[model samples]
Target: MTDHVDVLIIGAGLSGIGAAAHLTRELPRTSYVVLEAREVSGGTWDLFRYPGVRSDSDMFTMGYRFRPWRHEEALGSGERILEYLRDTAREYDVERRIRYSHRVIRVSWDSDTSLWTVEADHHGEAVTYTAGLVWSCRGYYDYERGHEPEFAGAEEFAGEIVHPQHWPDDLDWTGRDVVVIGSGATAVTLVPAMAEDAAHVTMLQRSPSYILSLPRRDPFAVRARRWLPAGLAHRVVRWKSILVTAVFYRLSRRRPETVRRMVRKQNVALLPEGYDVETHFTPRYDPWDQRMCFVPNADLFTSLRSGDAEVVTSTIERFDADGVVLTGGRHLHADVIVTATGLTLSPFGGIELEVDGEKVDPASLMTYRALMLGGVPNFVFTIGYTNASWTLKVGLVCEYLVRLLEHMGRHGYAVVEPRLPEGGMATRPLLDFGAGYVRRALDRLPKQGPRVPWVTSTAYGDDVRLLRRGPVADRHLVFTARAPRAPVAAEAAAGR
Candidate 1:
């Protein structure tokens, strides 16, 4: 038996729930299904259990518009974020739409019927779904595992070696000499938390990453939020953060030298006297090339300043039984190792799509506004705010999607897809990548077209205007109404 849905949402994370809430409000009677790969629905927060996993962005803007962030601190741990998500899902009745442990494998578009046939592995068995449209809410980061480093004798190390992505619960860190590899957020966050409990924590990296220290509080802002209404406060903070992030991002983007100088000055002020600022704080790439690290508690700096954690700039040549051996012949002993390597980016549910007979390569397509894949339209994907809170961009994307869906329904259109003009298209990276999942997937993902509607804008204000105020035709959206099917006669059926 075949069951059809108006929209098939993949993943039940923050994006998926936001999409559902928006869609349900707009199309109350419309049926949509969310197929999740994992049994639980919190996505990143539910998956990553490493120590000190939390949001780097402030909670004021990070929290949903419908929800109030009651947290005292700006940065919240994984559990608090998870709880918020869980509560949101329940309140919105989004959990009921999710099918747990259903991993989608393929989506084939049937030209004749104009439907997507989704194939999936469900409960050790296969199942098929036919849907009019598909919404990909799966985040870019790989939840399965983080990237692993290949060090000689890595397997022979006696101490427990683990990646932060799949951190174990029972492992004790008391009196252990912990070594954390990599200089990304994962490594930066792990350093202070581990240093607090471990005998000594050493951060091993090939090169230093640009780190910025920001307070964990928005005192006056928080007070205003409490005194005033939620709507006014949220909007104010959201715009404020967006502007600050954009200014810094643009400075790093255009005036790299000035930004670098400022970064160096900050580093020198915070770092120990006679310590090489170039060695532990300077990054070769531009500030925003890779996501700049943010220290919420200022604990990372505190640890380094107090000599609780040693930051070493050297390559890991190999892993010995007791510890690590560096490329320059230096050796360090460690009782535990944490490989805080970055993540892999892929489409949600790992869904492979084919058109007619040819397989559709996502990398060849240009992403429009970093939302829709080049050729695919009528569907929306919520990737969330990378440099800021996940919910800020997600909420805006949801609002835009609801508007689009409403427009489609009013026009009696069954599908809407983006198509490039017959000639050809140009391509480039959506987000700059020196390292991490985003960089690794750059070649394997879609490219954006030139200019607005097709191009990506770093400005949140521009995005909001483009999404909310622009003319419908400006988006290159192709709308199609449902075609009437010819009726089959009883006599013809009998003959058959």
Candidate 2:
């Protein structure tokens, strides 16, 4: 059948829930609905069932701005994060608005009607939602599957092969000789957590990644939450985290060696004496070139020191019945092979978009302030900071969204879309990242022009100026009145 909403939000994850909650506060009169692909809320937190699937970014910054992260966990576990999200939804009364198992397939915008026709699949049946605006909160990842490279003789491997994205609920990893492939966040998290009971966990990686150890509970935050009021305490801790992360990112970019040494010193201090820290911990690229992994309380290093887990930097020639065979002819015995390779990046939730019967190529359009895509009318997507907590940017977008909506309602504007300034602007990759996953999916993602309003920066300050405090009506944006449609025969008859 058909349904309509003033605003239709896709993906009832962290971003979507936050968007709804923001609307409930800022624009209470606005009607909206959240369409979720899965039966549960909490997107990534719900999808990933892997061991040690805690947030890479600190919870203070990752958590929503309106809602205070009442816990002391700087990096919260996946389950804990889910619980926090559930509480947020309940507190804001957002649960009833979420329509689970509504996987949106496509959205087509109609300028004539100033509405978007959204096609979705619900339990193998067709469902449609016509909305004035579409807020894409679904993240830029392939939820259907993760990125896994083909390894020769994998079929012959005797052990259970697992990918963390689709971790089995009943997989018995304890007391097993587990070999996890890759040295990214997933690998680092899995190696230590599974090593707790695994016979011996080995992390096989082609190269090393820079990893940092952060406190599970920040003393300052704990004290602030106890002494200060809830709102004031949250703001204090959040800004503190934001400033620290920004400063570290700045130092990482400006003085690479200085930051590198600091990380090395910390790693050496935590690991056992003469543990070959250089060989296992040193990354060829500078810090933040690829996203750095963070472990709470040096847990990864503790596991390494206790000899529960080990790191092997080598390329796999192939996989044999027993385990992985390195190019150097070294065979590592493994009863369980966990491929913590990475995720596949998918833009616009891999949903097809059409504008006035023409297919819109998202990769061709430049991102408008990293929230809305140019030339796409009444559409916005949430893509968070690669360097800092994701929700930091989400909060700004939500604020800007309310401002834009209020502006539109006041002016009786039916449609709004960003237009590139005259004399075509130069463009670059939206994400100036060096990660393998980003590099692999660069061609599929969007681009950014080399100036304000077009470029998507990682800095929170830029977002404050451009999105939060900035003017809603700008030269690059086009505002138009609603088009009139002929009355239907049924409506005419009913009126008579």
Candidate 3:
């Protein structure tokens, strides 16, 4: 017999657990089941076991609004984050709802029944499930593989090459020279982390990414927790973080030069005097163009200043047996090479979607309020903001979805689909990020319209007003009542 639920949530990660918690607390009547492909509940936290793996965004905003983070640290380690997710799952009893090691492969929506049929591989067995609504909380990154760029003579390299996504547990490069490729968050994080044990760690990048220094621990959070209730204190800190980050983002866009100088000055203050801040720390683009890297307590700078780590901003010509040969003909020796390259973006967890026997192409669909897709009914996908903390937008998204569902139930609507006007709407790429991972998978992703409700803004304030407080009934959304089923006898006669 196929399992059935009112809502089928895919991926028991941060978003998934948060969504489930919301459903349990807000929509208590809704029956839901969470399907996680991995054995563990924490998705990204469990997958990435690299050294110094931590959240780039602060925990106050990144954390779920309902569950107040009691930790003193703003930047939490991967293990600590995993513990948080597990604790959340246990506290909300969401752990019981999650079916681990179940990878959903396909989801098909039936218009007549107004239900979705999901197929998944559960512990090497194919299992089927039906649900009134399908909620995809799976994040954008591909968990199976990271974005590994091809390097000439990479195979000729004698040393071990590793990717941060699948970091080897047994591998140790202590007292050895290491070279980390890529200038993204992973590279920056790895350099200082690995430098502590390794003799020397070199961050090899084609270009620099805007990096900022932040305190590992939040003094405000610590003080607030002592005086106020944990929940209230969390909210206070969260809002404060939101306001500051929002202002910074706005300033970066409005006054790029001013923000650039400020960021450069901050970096210079952390590093040794006369250090090549322009060459290594300075990015070609303005701040907020790409997501900025945050190094807690100026750890990366500390490592650099101590001569344990260094940065090399140049293109790689080829990988030699000893190390890498730069375009300028400089050869760096390395004992281990860590490919801290970017991630591969996969929408809807790379699951095949069909609507009434018609294969749905994600690229053909336009995003509706950045949650649901146009022409898709009874489905919602949670995607976080690129500019701000991920959970801030995701929390709003979950709240909005619950509101929409309640509205639909009261109206006796079986399906809700956003339909564009008769005239074609001008469309653009969904994400405005210039990151390599985003650019690599832009063609396969969904599109966004030029107008409101269709275009997704990274600004959390705008999203809160639109998604959290906006009306459920909109001009573009089309709701349909469920059609009556045929008689059993008639169906048998037709089959005979």
TM-score of each candidate? 0.93, 0.97, 0.96
Off by over 4 Å in 2: 484-496
lDDT of 2: 0.90
- Winner on TM-score (1 vs 2): 2
Which pairs of residues collide in candidate 3? none
Cα lDDT of model 2 by residue, 1-496, tens digit:
4667778899888999999899888887777888999999999999999998999999998999888887778998999999999888888777888888999999999888888889999999998888889999998999989999999999999889999999999999888899999999999999889989999999998989999999999998999988999889999999999999999999999999999999999999999998887788999999999998999999999999999999999899999999999998999999999999998999888899999999999999899999999999999999888888999999999999999999998988888999988777898998999988899988988899888888887899878888889898889999998656422222111111
Write the residue-wise lDDT of candidate 3 on 316-411 in tens digits: 999989999999899999999999888999888889999999999998899999988999998899999899888998999999999998998898
Each prediction's number of clashing residue pairs: 5, 0, 0
Report the lDDT of model 3 for residue 471. Answer: 93
The local lDDT score (0 to 100) that residue 9 gets in candidate 3 is: 93
TM-score of 3: 0.96
Query: Candidate 1's residue-wise lDDT over 328-381, tens digit each?
Result: 899889999998877867754456877654688777777766677756645567
Off by over 4 Å in 1: 484-496
